[model samples]
Target: MKNLNKLYILLFAVLVFATSCEDLTEINEDPNRPTEVPVEYLLTSAERQLGNRLYGGFDNVAFGMTVSQYWAQNEYSDETRYQFRANTNNTFWSDFYTAINDLQEIKKVNTTIDKGQQGINQNAVATILQSWAYHSMVDIYGDIPFEEALQGVDIPSPAYSDQELIYSALIDSVSSAVAAIDPSAPGFPGGDVIFDGDLSKWQKFGNSLLLRIGIRLSDVNPSLAEQTISAAAEGAMKSNADNAAIQYITAQPNVNPLYVSYVVNGRQDYCATENFIELLNGLGDPRIGEYFVPAANTGTFEGLPYGVTSAVAAGISRDAVSQLNPQVYAADFPGTLMGFVETSFILAEAASNGWIGGSAADYYAQAITASMNYWNITDGNAIGDYIAANPYTEDNLKVQKYIAMYYEGWQSWAEIRRLDLESLPAANLVEIDPAVNFVDVSNILNRRLYPQDEQNLNGANYQNAASNIGSDAYDTNLFWDLD
Candidate 1:
């Protein structure tokens, strides 16, 4: 009887121990946090972050809009007057790097979990996005971490890469990515927000981006530029349907950047600049009404002069200056990354340079027509008349390009620098208030200064880059900016 009772006790103890062990394991697992996230979720997050960085934030409002002279602040004109802050600079740098990191992770996971053609398709998309993010950073800062970037624990302090070398790598990466994508392959169906898993559109986007990079190197390496542009022109974006854009939802977190900035924040800081308005109005461009609302008091479109002092701006009535159109600030407005119109313009430039087969004038007219249509100016006669009035001269090409790039502030600023659009800044400065004579209008910023954190954290590499690029100043011209 004693032996049987001991056996029973042992059996009970074993059961209790097993149950407790299972409970312990369950408790150790966290429901609130995830060790690994789906690559689809990561892609969505990256797209949203990129949109926020490009379309919203101080970087867009202060540096992009101000430098482009598309919009000017009612007060606190430091950013508009070419005064950059370290905090703002750091924000732009960090945000883009974060998005790039997310893209890299997607590539890693897609390689691990997916195989064959599907894996190739996923990786190609990630590579294209990574290329774009890197290009934006390189264009803004001149030199940045490229080869060793997004290495996680492997490279805590990556060295800065040369801008020219970085551009070359980006061009190659994008070209390879475009080639790797197979439209027939199975795609990660829900992952793509921009094109909804359409591999062909992604291919077109990559090719269009290639064209942009190719043209960007025209002045520095004309032969390579010509070769690259010719190849890209064969498969680039064909029409507005292929434009790379992020469509925002009319909801809390997914609202458009302009809506978050203007509506949710209730900030009336930015108004259309006279520089932009005058250019459109002078050309009788129909996009003027589409881009801005008529002033509240005057019941007509008016704009504040760019780079004005606070006192000069204060004298003007706020109600008389044109604010951005409400439609642009709508929650569902799509945030454009690259557009078909831009591709058309690039083709026009390539034609003019004799790098491609098309007639420059025909490409120019197509580009203007595309731009007008993009802004909802669908009238055939109106577009034809505008095209007729504005001939395909080099000046007209540059001017129309500038006008077409209304809300695309950073690109506009870069294009002005690359093309040396003398009239853009020159004509605007002539109208500057005499009382606001402190700023040297002749020395407009060519590039943004490196964030102060780079100096502190990556001291040696930062110093080397600064030395290579000439003082890390805003006035320093990038390698491609011959002007």
Candidate 2:
């Protein structure tokens, strides 16, 4: 009887301990912290991430503005001289991929949870944004890992797809996304910052992006370009109202990137390039004042010489050269991902190339008008006068597009290379200061070299891509860049 009692008590104690362990496990899960976030939150995060990188100070000025010669470094001058920082390059490469991954997650979550019209719309928006980010990446770095990029551990080293193949996939994806959007459905009621869940606007943006992508393949794959451009032209953005942009707020994490780079950081590190400002001045452009401020010292719009040595740059007075206008860096300024002005210019180019059914001259005039209006050049007379003076010749079309694309450094650089504008006198591709040749190459940058991390982490794939891309030199033209 004693042994029986002891055995029973031991069994009861064992059961109690097991119950306590289960209770402890349950307590570990805090209700305040969620393992998974809603898809809408993911959308906002992905958009914000891309917005900051695209328009923010570091990558924006270092790689895009400086390389394109829109804005030169006022102090360091290294990036302006084409010596891009390794960290800047790495951040640009990684940040874009990170945003793309987030967008991919949104698509997956929406597809699984909501199979209804709302899910369809959400998926479409995510697809379009993914394409936009990929397009920009391909344009800058030539070939990139597209289909297999965001697979995490499953595919640690994604092989770089051919640029031609990537373009085809992007066109098809964008078209499908546009078709999938249900205008009647309410999409992301809370997190749709770009268009406020407006499916129609998203459709227009998708089509416009399609047009842009198609135009890029004009030289490499003319048949596909023509087909894609013709189909996209009808559905592209109709006005500035359809612009795919995000307006920042005057708050902690949402301030305009320019404001953070200039005002918040209190850095006087950038100024207008002599080439860009002089071109605007000679054209009698009204937006010069809108684009830059008059030098405080001279009370005139002077520009710092492009690609000069830091020693030479140090000699120049900060108050002597025009700085970016305060309006540009204002906290409430909008970061444009794509807008009507760009679509108009793309249409003009497509029409000029005989890929679309429109008068090239008419499209060109509209593009110029749109650009002036975008800059808030209130004087209609000034816009008309400028357009009339610079008619729709092929050369004029490229030059006007370059000017209109001010502050849009990546697009400007891509266009300049795509059109082979280096030969044009107005492009001012040759060194301004012949005595000081900053870059090793005579021509402007063609493509950015792949991030060093790629070489280190994904060695075999990186080696193959670099080898296939003809040495990965900065001057190596992309597959689309026949020139």
For lDDT, the strongest prediction is: 2
- Per-model CA lDDT versus the true structure: 0.84, 0.86
- lDDT tens digits, residues 1-483, model 2? 999999999999999999999999889878898766788888888888888999877777777887778788788887776777777778888999998999899887775685688888888999999999999999999888887799989999999887778888899999999998889877787787788778899999999999889888888888998899899899999998899987788996777888887888898688999888888888888889989999899888889888888988988988889998888888878888888988998898888888888899899888888888888875787778888999889899889888888888888889999988777898665554534555576577899989989888888888888888887888888999988
RMSD of each: 3.5, 1.9
Per-residue error for 223 in candidate 2, Å, reads 1.1
Clash numbers, per candidate: 0, 0
TM-score of each: 0.92, 0.95
Could you tell me which 10 consecutive residues in candidate 2 have the lowest summed lDDT? 429-438
Candidate 1 lDDT, 298-357, residue by residue in tens: 888889988788777778877989988888888998888899999999999999999999
Which pairs of residues collide in model 1? none
